[model samples]
Target chain A: MTPIHAPDVLISEVGPRDGLQSVSGTMSTAAKCLWIDALAAAGLREIEVASFVPPKLLPQMADAAQVVQHALRHTHITVMALVPNLRGAETALRSGARKITLPISASQAHCLANVRKTREDMVAELRAVVALRDAIAPGVPVEAAISTAFGCTLQGQVPEDDVLRLAVACAEAGASDVGLSDTTGMGNPAQTTRLFKRLFQEIGERTGAAHMHNTRGLGLANCLAAYEVGVRTFDSSLGGLGGCPYAPGASGNVVTEDLVFMFEAMGVSTGIDWPTLMAAREPLKAGLPGETLYGMTPEAGLPKGWRG
Target chain B: MTPIHAPDVLISEVGPRDGLQSVSGTMSTAAKCLWIDALAAAGLREIEVASFVPPKLLPQMADAAQVVQHALRHTHITVMALVPNLRGAETALRSGARKITLPISASQAHCLANVRKTREDMVAELRAVVALRDAIAPGVPVEAAISTAFGCTLQGQVPEDDVLRLAVACAEAGASDVGLSDTTGMGNPAQTTRLFKRLFQEIGERTGAAHMHNTRGLGLANCLAAYEVGVRTFDSSLGGLGGCPYAPGASGNVVTEDLVFMFEAMGVSTGIDWPTLMAAREPLKAGLPGETLYGMTPEAGLPKGWRG
Candidate 1:
């Protein structure tokens, strides 16, 4: 009924979009809404509810607009969507999403494979998306995330200089905020800390979330590295959903529950109830039956009297 | 073979002792030797080869002396053993252990549950062990690990002042080094960094290894926090072998393979060969048939051209 104090850190839940898209089977539109509503009920202030991609390309997200519409009902949540280009951006804007995130690959090989666009081409597309958003839904923040900014499976070691240059390009192209993503989960804490420090030096307050992956089990550590260097926003998925489905035992975003546990346990406010956050996993499992959910906290449970 | 440069960090392999003892089924003595040989061949310089305990308490460690003898054959490795008290220490010293580690629980509740001794009683036991070591093996190091120094399962939060006081007591009792152990995996990075910092201030160079567990999935993060605060030695179980079996999905030490990967990828010299370390798991699995081996780096193959 009343306003809750803003959490010391902002954890944007990207499970519905990133997790669902990576899976082969499509979760029903109603089930996705239920999951999204469950995440918001657990006190997540932001949720990337959908991705506006064509049905033919990704049938998992064919009901993206409906998911966005349903999530918009949570007045306390900033409903966000991801887009690959200006066309998807137009659709996302019309769907009444409050925030938009555009993915631009730092590794040229990954960019070409995912979107068939060069780095320069993607930046130009980002500029176009920002312009379109200004013309229609003014004040809707557009964020650019540099994917594979840590390293790429194709390129092996992504150059740090290249990542910094591309981040500046996103900022110059009018992205309200720019973030670094370990899309391949090849990042180490040292690199995560260094890159974020350099990103802040280059872009100042324009730096956004640290979207780390647990592919190598260093996700939470990398988040700690980023936080030590002044990162305040993080993007994680519920149940450690989504990943390079191509690689066995690899997953995309860090588990939201575990990340929340690490920060909240350390006396950092995440504004989410630990028990309630753990309970939200049921809706996710219900929506996507038989999927192997990953998270040590969920499996091990919290320490005795962790809340007390 | 020419001498290899010492690694920047030391990874003390504790699986043969901690991991084997926790499981219900016993690994054959020959199999334990084979596993220890593999770990040494992979460049692990120190291995906690066995726990010198009574056969009735843990049949898995029934062949403690034989395993320690086999591990000693490596010559390069510091064959360490865990001793509960003066009796185990006398046997371990007679068997030629290069180092001895005594577990002194910081939490009174854990101390009572584990050794049926109070914290002060454990400190007195440690003093006796150190005295015996000096008479029989003067040069050998006697380390005391303050388990549950971070938090305890039976008794909610363990006070920081209490942990610091225990470390001081261990140092005063002639522990060659005093380290912190997150026996319950309830530690967070902030708590880890703060506690280790205070420990360093109190004991200086006497600070020992950080034995972090992955129960709540913050193991690596906690290790990083300790490392950042100047604690170098780390205790880990290969494949995350040991854990709290009472709680489903709970785990013990940080996975050595993944810990090696984190440091190596960050350009920190672990001195251990990555591929060889991964291969070592085969012998462990062979030894403990049907046991679930855990590690993400082994599950997700290394990044392309990571060696290059």
Candidate 2:
């Protein structure tokens, strides 16, 4: 085994939860386990195995518990799951998720459209999840991922004040960590730096990962801005999956390969096996044949003499 | 006309020169002029109109003088051109190019391959071009674009020392400014920040634009790193033109549309009108009928209610 040491950055993989959920097809439980195994073998320290949502709503995550259990077997990898409310949180805890993310939209319109709840309702839901985590899984961290913190498709120009207010509300409501999500891919570098800086100022250590998208092609830049502002954890997907279903050709989350490549090239340690990470794509593609996978690094291949 | 004011950053369009040079097809002269007009109408302050290489070598730029002359008509825009040697520089000056860029590679192999000259020879060429400028075009600025400043496909991992030394050599040779170019798209954000920082340390205000590529999909992130280190001018293409022809689908230059969107969304004024910029893509597509055009902001459309 490789020597254990904290990496310069943590690129948390969300493909299983976010990528699979965004796609139309449901992968078999066996393929899911294999894909998760490949990612873990590639040295990913954290992997969001699945979202504990109703299988009727998102059939792709029907085997969330089994996926979580398989991922939990890799003690070195922190297993994560997404939850909507108390019930999902309870399921995630029972499945042995080490970390749980609760998506709470900063935009009222998006929150109402996404979960049939307003921002206030999301806050209440976050509180309920936090309480459930404390009682059932005391050590598991509950992350409030503030979606559409930059701008919204339903409403334009999400006020920075509202985002900060929601972040503070989440922290006060007992979230172990509060993160920003550019759910609509409308964030800019300045806004990212400003928001994250404010996050640190208000919530201190509770500031969490930056879940950015490449929809407008500023995903890496936004992540760089967050890193400059001291954000260590990042949420990305394999092959850049999970695009907004309504927006055609919209790149989903920032590609995990690209993000790790950036960090490694910058002389920052990511603790990932680059070749193994790239090879993991084979299982990813095999898991869901005929599904379109997107990533510049994989398509472009590695540059000549890339040590990674 | 909108009020004339300095934008926070200068995004110099390089499609007509770099874009056309890399593509196999030769766009008509009329198409070039019309595309330039569309870009000017979009409020880009500077645009590299053409490259003054011999027609036999690069037939796409055969109409360099005419293109430069046409772009010069827009008094508000600073028309620029690329040159490889003193002969090309002389032709560029005669064509009334307001600014000129001479691509000098920091990697010895790239320098030898690109210009059949060593880095030392390129420095001599820069000196000759500067001398000619002092005689024929006293006011025009000559930019020395240090391509492969970060890394090279031919000789991977271009030393940071070489890039800084070349920048100083150009500046001392009377070059107006020296810029860094990730021609091979092997640049990392940290390397970019480090190299640019060193360039500024050695040759303060003489530092110039960041000519980055999205070969590995970190173009915008690298640009952000340079911007963070006080770079204000950036070179990009309308449709991300001029990729390394050897590598298929390696995104060429940073897309001007996406780069402009990044700066604009950051509230850092690029002075580029958003809708007008998107509209400019129509002329670009028309100019190159069968040629592929690439950009995210163009395909994704504006996010709900973008002010630009």
In terms of TM-score, how similar is model 2 to the real structure?
Answer: 0.96
**Cα shift from native, residue B79, model 2 (Å):** 1.6
Highest DockQ, which number?
1
lDDT of each: 0.88, 0.87
- As a whole number from 0 to 100, the lDDT of residue A176 in candidate 1 is 95
Best by lDDT: 1
**Please, what are the lDDT tens digits per residue for candidate 2 over residues A4-119?**
67678888999988888887777899998999999999989989889999999988888899889888889999899999888899999998999999998998999988888888
* lDDT (Cα, 0-100) at A252 in candidate 2: 67
True contacts kept of each: 0.77, 0.74
Writing each residue's lDDT as its tens digit, candidate 1 over A64-132 gives 999999999999999999999999999999999999999999999999998999999999999999999
Clashing pairs in 2: none
Chain B TM-score against the true chain B, candidate 1: 0.96
> Model 1 compared with the native: what TM-score?
0.97
Model 1, residue A278: what's the lDDT? Answer: 78
